[model samples]
Target: MKAIIAGTTMPVLELTLDAGERIIAEGGDVSWLTPGFDIQTSTAFGSGGRGGFMSGLKRMVGGGQLFLTQYTAQAPGSFVAFAAQLPGTIRELAIDPQDQFMVQSGAYMASTPDVEVSVGLQKKLGAGIFGGAGVVFQKLAGNGTAWVQLAGEIVEYDLQAGQSLLIHPGHLALYRAEMPLEFASIKGIKNKFFGDSLFLAQLHGPGHVWLQSMTPAKLAAAIEPYLPEKSSSDNN
Candidate 1:
């Protein structure tokens, strides 16, 4: 199996399967597919499914299952998973006939014809506390290779065994599960206060650190002015 991410800005991830490999995404992420590949999205990702405000409102008013599909065949025991970063916690598991599942921040069971899934959680630190530092979490179970898609500029930091690196929080995406994560000071308080530098999450590693190109705050700033009047008022 091979993977290639396409497009610019809002790029798409394409996985090419060789006859028997399979991929899983939520019901709403499918855009297009060919015979050798399949596409689905996380229920919490993209503009639809369980993640969008409008979509959630719709689900609450009218209860039903969302449909999803794959463009290829699987070897019967192979599985893949996809998810979106969600606020709060996940409470249930929702899966479609095409081997897709939706997970929250809680534990769920799995069975045949359904891809096994588990949810993980992270605490949201106030931006004032960590400033430019970003928090990163990793998949502790499964195949140890989880793919995370983010909405910002991403920078990769290469590290050697026993080495350490510091990065702003807003840039982090995912890292190796074996790496240790912690918060570290940015040295002098005066420098942090004066904008000379900011606090960072110190990663001690022998692995790769993935950072996103965009941040939630930056995205909110771009969309704040365009929201409907009532929505804008709610933010205030």
Candidate 2:
């Protein structure tokens, strides 16, 4: 199979598969492919598979399943498939890269044992102040290794064992869940005043750490202009 990501921001992924090759995607994430394809979301995802009246009504009538078919078959056996599960759902598509097949997610993370990631603050933050920002720290508990993926460019800092690196919350995607985290004060008053550079989560590492280039803030900034305007009354 051969795959190519075509178009600019909001790119389309084209996959060419040989005979007997298949590609699968979770229900809602089908947008990663073409515009039109059948997406079968399950109840486990709160898609109304076994929810209350309002939930089922919301899902079934509000576009029962998202179906689209603008895909051009690059090769035979290049079929797309979907599945529903009660417990574990394979929302990610894993394909063999050697066969020209490519599987990509909007954003995802992977971690190994001996790594721990936790919220930096002892108390929950108010949205008014944090603005969707939350500090997380990554650390190595025992001797082990792990890796994480971010959406955009990642700036990595090298620290010797027991040394730690502080990073902005927007720059973080996922880290080892076991790492201990706490809200620590900024060093200098000047750094704290800058806002952007203030109150970072400290990641202590005997393990590896990764960050993404694209962040929710960056994404919202890029697309906000294109979003439909809301009426002043709607704000009420």
Candidate 3:
């Protein structure tokens, strides 16, 4: 299978598959597809393995869909497309036994059949509470290619073993699964008006980290004041 990301802001993933080629993704992620494809919806593992029920439950609790959808090409030249939910970039990463990643909630889109996505739980309560995406992020493992959507522009950093970066939770997009994350309180800083906490996410790494310029929550907050309010009549 071949994957190409098209467009600028709000990019789309277009996948071209040969006969019998397959791709797996969370249910409801497909924006469009051509004819001559066999689609299966199930709770089974992306690799067509066992433990459908337990895996499904874990995925749902991790802010992912309970069912996964598999798309198979009936013949060569078949194609399927998935669009980014926000105005952002769609990135394709190569995954393998030695390379894995953890992604924030709503960042993952689709992957090859051999890839697996599971819950990546934060170790500390402080990191869980202030991380914006909660304790459970999506862990992408196994051996294949995976596609992810990140809001706005993407910035990449390759950190040395002892190097670290303090980040606002919402800006943390994706990172190497082996990286360690902790929370730090900003001294002398208080956000009483906006209800933001002084805590920030500190990620320590000997690996790569990707940060996004925008987040859904922050975008919503920026537009909330401009949105029309419901009237008393609409409530009825």
Candidate 4:
């Protein structure tokens, strides 16, 4: 299968498959497709082996589908496309046996059949429980290419050994497995105004990190005021 990411600012992943090739993606991400393709939903696993019911539940909490959708091409010249939810960029990463990436929860889009998507957990309780950032994430592993979407614009930084960067939790998009990540407390009165010790993601890296200009949480907050307010009568 040959894949190309077309467009910027709301990019879409277009895949052209040869006979018998397949691709898997998250549920609700499908935009369009061509003939000679079969879409199947499986709760076990997307790549190979078995991920039982319990595993599927865990994956759902990690921000993926309980059942994944697979598109298999029955003949050559078949095609499929998946679109990102937000106005941002779609990125492709090649995964080798020695490489694994920690994707922001809900950021994964699609992947070649050889890739496996699973959960990644943050060991730190500060970010996991106290902070609003997610503790579970979609872990992309195996030897294949995986696609992910970042909200709004994307920024990348390569940090040398012992180098660190502090970022708001909502802005983190993706980071390499080797990078050190933890939550740090914001000192002083700003925490009181915000309702808690405003936490930041402290990334100490000898690897790469990606940040997004817009996050779902931030976007919702921005537009919350314009949304219809709940009325007392509606509670009935």
Candidate 5:
């Protein structure tokens, strides 16, 4: 199977499959498909293994869909495409040595059959205290290529061991398997109230991280003022 990533700013992923080649993707993410490809919906499975119903439930716990769509080519030269639901870019990553990466929920698009997607690590409840929203990232592992979609304008960082980066919870998109993801409170009582953010995420990496310039929450906040307001006139 061959995959082509097309366009910029709002990219699309197109896969050309040989007969019998199969791919698994996030449910509801498919934009189009060529003839001879058979589509099936199930929990995400890989050349590595197929997960059970309980696994599907677990996937949902981490903000992933309970069902995944599998597309297989019945004949030669079949094609399938996935378009991002947000205005952003699609990333093609290689997962070797069973590389495990944590990605934001809904960032997964599609992957070669040898790859697998599962629920990410759960955080402690105290982590979310004081309005600090802890994150649950989707764990992508196994040996293969995985495609992920990140929100507007990607910024990359490579940190040395013991070095850390403070981030807003919403801006985090993806990080390497070995990176440490932790939660921290805003320092200082005055800054807590007057600072730009009340809570922050700390990424301590001996690996790579990807952050988005526009998270959904940030985007909504930016446009909230322009949204139509309700008034007595609405009752008329």
Candidate 6:
């Protein structure tokens, strides 16, 4: 199979498959496909063929679909495409037993059949206690290629052993699964007095980390004040 990533700011992933080649993605993520392609939707496979129903359930809990869609090429030169939902970049990760990734929920797009998407983290201590929000991350493991969509500009950092970075929870996009991740409250009395963010994500690594500059929540908050307000007559 050959893959091509097209466009900028809102990229699309196009895969050209040889006869008998198969790819898997979450249900409804396909943008388009060629004719004569065999499509199968099931709960028992895709995402690495792990535990069937239980695997599907875990994916759903991590903000993914319970059903997975597999596209097979019946003839030569068949193709399928997946488009990014937001104005950002689509990145491809090499998944294997040694190299795996933990991606924020809703980041997964598609992957080879051997890749597995499972729940990584359901909640963080600081986020659960201070923020009242449960954060979810999806683990991409197994041996294959996987695609993830990140919002806005992406920055990559390679951390040596014992190196750490503090990140806002929303900006945390994808990182090596081996990296240690946790949430911690921000220090300094000035920040507390000024009502700054209470908690930040701490990631320690001997691996790479990817951070996105924009998130859906930040975008919504930015434009919310400009939106027209509702009136009493509108309510009626």
- lDDT tens digits, residues 62-81, model 3? 67888899999999999999
Model 5: CA > 4 A from native: 44-50, 124-134, 189-197, 228-236
Comparing candidate 3 with candidate 5, which one achieves the higher lDDT?
3
Of candidate 1, the 10-residue stretch with the lowest lDDT total is: 103-112
**Which lDDT value does model 5 have at 112?**
81
The stretch of ten residues in a row with the least summed lDDT in candidate 4 is: 122-131
So what's the TM-score on candidate 6?
0.89
**Candidate 3 collision pairs:** none
Better of 3 and 6 by TM-score: 3
Candidate 5 residue lDDT tens string, 119-205:
776664343332334467888888888999999999999999889999876788999978877777676534434364355788896
Q: Model 3, which residues run further than 4 Å from truth?
A: 47-50, 122-135, 193-197
True-vs-predicted CA distance for residue 1, candidate 6, Å: 0.8
Q: All models: lDDT?
A: 0.43, 0.36, 0.83, 0.79, 0.80, 0.86
Clashing pairs in 5: none
Better of 1 and 4 by lDDT: 4
Q: What digit string (tens of lDDT, one per residue) describes model 4 on residues 1-236?
A: 78889988778889999988888887678899996677888876544444667656767767688888888899898999988788999888988767778888889898887777877754443434424444455778777889999999889999999899988867888988767788887775255434556768898978989999998877877899999989999999
Q: Rank the candidates by lDDT, best first.
A: 6, 3, 5, 4, 1, 2
2 against 3, candidate with superior TM-score = 3
Top-down TM-score ranking: 3, 6, 4, 5, 1, 2
- Per-candidate clashes, comma-separated: 14, 19, 0, 0, 0, 0
TM-scores of the candidates are 0.51, 0.44, 0.91, 0.87, 0.86, 0.89
TM-score of 2: 0.44
Alpha-carbon RMSD, candidate 6? 2.9
Output the number of the TM-score-best candidate.
3
